[model samples]
Target: MKMRNLPPLNALKMFEAVARNSSFSLAAEELCITHSAVSHQIKLLESWMGVKLLQRHSHGATLTPAGQILFTTCVQLFNSLENCINDIQQKPINHGITLGAPSSFMANWLISRIESFEEKYPEIQIKLMTSNDFKLLENEQIDLQILSLNRQVQLKSDLVKIHLFKDKIGPVLSSEKAHNITQPSDLLTQTLLHTESNKNAWSFWATQHQVKLNEAKNQRYFDHLNLMLEAAANGLGIAIAPEILVEKQILNGQLIAPFGFTDSDAEFTLCLKQNCLKNSNLQTFIEWIQYQVSID
Candidate 1:
């Protein structure tokens, strides 16, 4: 058997940091090292590789073609190493699977239904992580991710995507404020709430309904959809949200969807690595979640 020759591990670590951040100074700060030390390590790496890895500019640095290739490999290697460490550290505990999803979905949809899964699979523990970063999947930080995507968009080849449910969105407001929004035009007279992540959701709905938002005078923006929905329930304004998320609020008489929901091109999807289903526990979760969505 032949041993593989590798670059200096420390130098590779510094190079990865610099490439990921696109700034030597920021990487140095994150690594708690001097800027000059970071530069030295990068130079050492470049000397060994005999290639110009980075193109420096006044603003920051950009990776060369070779650098990009190396960076990609390094990211995959590091994530695998981290996951291995985590699995070893948590082996004494119950078998755990980390699930990541958007904050709004986690709070409004999954949280209420997760207890059923936990009760059914007592030996398998679920760890909830809320993040909109899809890159986390590639980083191996989460075993599975729940994402909302337009049906037209395509994912990478190595990822496996499962259809969860159709996404239907509509304008929702407090019961007291619903009366004022009898028609689409009536929205112009009310303050429209928007989520920063999906700033164009209202526009998309308006276009589909043949309603114009150009004359809408008052509007507010929230960082999260859950916060925007809470504002609507509190009578702050009318917010456009997915029906699945606002079902409980509407059922509780806190919100009213006078216009009713319209089917959108987007749908909730479950994304995981191609090989993830090999794990029985994870496979069980996939089956259970698919069943849940099917019944819903």
Candidate 2:
């Protein structure tokens, strides 16, 4: 770091540009200086180092053994400096954030709100993967997850968990299909659509209403809430849906909630490996989610 022992940085930069391009004119063009200025800096660098770095030819220039060594070192040094600057500036140096969640939540909830998040943080690119498997985070395949968990579920203690909100369950049907039913028991005559992931949703709603459901009817089952809600909107049958995921559909008249919603023991939670909490991109996304919840 002693300034007296080092050659001038401007001279070193000029020499590097000349050596890289093998032409003083090209280096001067890149540095926005006259060709004579580039030649003068190169002479200054050689005088300071007491070694001839470039062997000038009639057509161009070539690096001597000493010059080649210096050029290689300069390339690495400049590249490292650029990387440090990028990290300090919070500029993107690699692929952006990656998140994982269940298929239903990804399709029904997060997909709808992602555009606003993108608009707010245009510099950060977000990739969403749908999988029920939590192992992806352990393998470093995903940075974080939006997990839906029942109260009885247990997770590793080291993982950071943030509770966004609890989910509520209710019957959702199309407007035309919902008009026939005046009471809860009237659902006995209609075919019911079921989501395999939330098999207990209807039972929770029925318990809240103090009504028994007729289970003998043939019920159609879907693996995710997105498909079940879509089926209900198409008048396939009345589906036991989560209020949080289907709120927009109900508001748009795509689906109707005949009976009011009831709280379920399940919660919608944000999960990430403890170390990922320090990542700025993930932090921004988590703060956005918190902001959304506050407004709701």
Candidate 3:
């Protein structure tokens, strides 16, 4: 096979960093290199490739059309390399388990309890991947998944599903703002916070309670539930969230669940390949997590 010439690896690395960040200065800061050095390397890369990759403006940089193609390839290449390295590293002892779940659940519930699990089973290492998409489990990228789904939905026959807890959702806001929101109708006068991943959360709650939600009400949306919760705690707006995710905030007096939680059709559930439990480390983690949920 004929070996194809490739761009310098270091320059490619810098290019990926700069393109990913959209700023040479930020890339330099991340890579521990000088701004001028990044510029020089990018220039060298452009010269070697005979095409401009970035357009520098006063604010930062933007990728050229060719740069976009290269960037996409670089991202996939780097990700595959990382997975290869991780697989190689874990092959010997194989005590590591990669668990995927929604960001809100991982941030608000799982992370705090992870320390206890680690203390009890020091030999087991848990790698958490935050994602709302359960389809990731089909790709075999992760060993287990924590999914939030409607109770009425049928489980996939090929996978093992365990009920972790019922998802109880309600409207929450800063305690100071709670007083003004005495009833569900008051929400119409205030800004309603929404999360992109759970777009129907407020609507679902409203439908369940037979509350007429005003479509034209003031509203704000966040990419993740955690961010929306933070905005709510900061008095930005009222947010609908699962009780488990906002329990700490409610207890700390930072937020209040004015409506209190009601059972949603949804529930948090654990999922894994049918045969995954055969792995001793994964089995131990599954047992520990189930016990944790039982006690909680």
On the 0 to 100 scale, the lDDT of residue 153 in model 3 is 76
**Which pairs of residues have clashing backbones in candidate 3?**
none
Output the lDDT of residue 218, model 3.
Answer: 86
Instruction: Record all residue pairs in model 2 with backbone atoms less than 3 Å apart, i.e. clashing.
Output: none
Query: Between candidates 2 and 3, which one is better according to lDDT?
Result: 3
TM-score winner between candidates 2 and 3? 3
Best by lDDT: 1
Ranking by lDDT: 1, 3, 2
Instruction: List TM-scores for all candidates, in order.
Output: 0.69, 0.65, 0.70
lDDT of 3 by residue, 1-296 (tens): 99879999899999988986779999999999899999999999999999888889999987654675576557546755766887888854345787888756765787568768878987777666655666778777788899888878776777888889999999999987877877788877788999987888888888887777775368899876766877888889999999988888889797898889999888998888887858888888888988988888
Q: How many residue pairs clash in each candidate?
A: 0, 0, 0
**Over the stretch 1-296, how does candidate 2's per-residue lDDT look in tens digits?**
86577799999899878876778888999999999999999999999999889889888786654675576456546655655798999897665777777756654566557768988888987666655667977777678877778877777876878899888888889999987988887776677888887787777777777767765255788865766776788888889977887887888799888877878888888888887788888999999988887787
Model 3: how far residue 91 lies from native, Å = 6.7
Q: Candidate 3: how large is its RMSD?
A: 10.2
